[model samples]
Target: MLLGGLLGGALDLLYAFGFAASRGVAPTRLLQTIASGLQGQAAYEGGTASAALGLFSHFAMSLAWAAGFALLASRVGWLRQRPAFAGPLYGIVVFLAMRCVVLPLSAYPHPVGFPPLSTSLDLLSHMFLFGLPIALLVARALRR
Candidate 1:
């Protein structure tokens, strides 16, 4: 689960940076925004430290979601039996958990305000880049 989280988080961060850059948003600002979830907007002013924190926070969140799925997969035989299908669905679950619960209650930019295209892209990324990797990795662990 830890390995899946780390790799998936790194992959997701890369995808996020590219997505944000294409939209005229600075990558550093995006990283800072991750930290903002915990430190509020002031995290942007924190410079390198805040970016570091953001990176850490991002991985922590990924790890948590991965752990959650791993726990469930371990306990639920049906889930372990169908990674290809369940993975993307779990990604959607992770996305909703963040947008509806995690981000809403956090201090990050309010309302999320993702454009239609961006929103779709984010959802796809979560499914393929985030949740799928975690699911596949955890599934592999189960096989072992």
Candidate 2:
């Protein structure tokens, strides 16, 4: 389980880094941008502290997500048997939950100039950057 969680979290971090690379944006900058959007004024006021907190929070969230995936895979026969597809499926579920449920409920202020195209890009980015890799990793672990 620990191995699976570590692998999942590592893959997520790698995917996030890759996403930043593809966008020609520094990961720190991208995170800062996101933090700003999420936290409003304090995101910029505290600068390094805000970014650090945001990054640490993200890391912790990733670890928890990985752990949850590991636990679910262990308890769910279907997930264990078909991790490849299941992993991606799990990602999709999370994506939908965030987009349709979580974000809507939280009502966080979106950045100005964030248009529909950007929204689509963000969704696709999450799918490939976070979802796909997690799914693949989970699938691989389940295979064994």
Q: Estimate each model's TM-score.
A: 0.95, 0.65
The digit string of per-residue lDDT tens for model 1 on 1-144 reads: 999899889989999999889889887788899999999979989998998899889999899989999999999887778888778899999988888888989997657766799889999999999888888899999989
For candidate 2, lDDT tens digit of each residue in 48-110?
A: 776776576565655666667767877888776766566667766665776676545542455
Error of 1 at 73 (Å): 0.1
Candidate 2 residue 8 Cα shift, in angstroms, is 4.6
Show model 1 residue runs off by greater than 4 Å. Answer: none
Give me the runs in candidate 2 sitting further than 4 Å from their true place: 1-26, 34-38, 105-107, 111-129, 132-144
lDDT measured at residue 42 in model 1 versus the true structure, 0 to 100: 94
- Best model per lDDT: 1
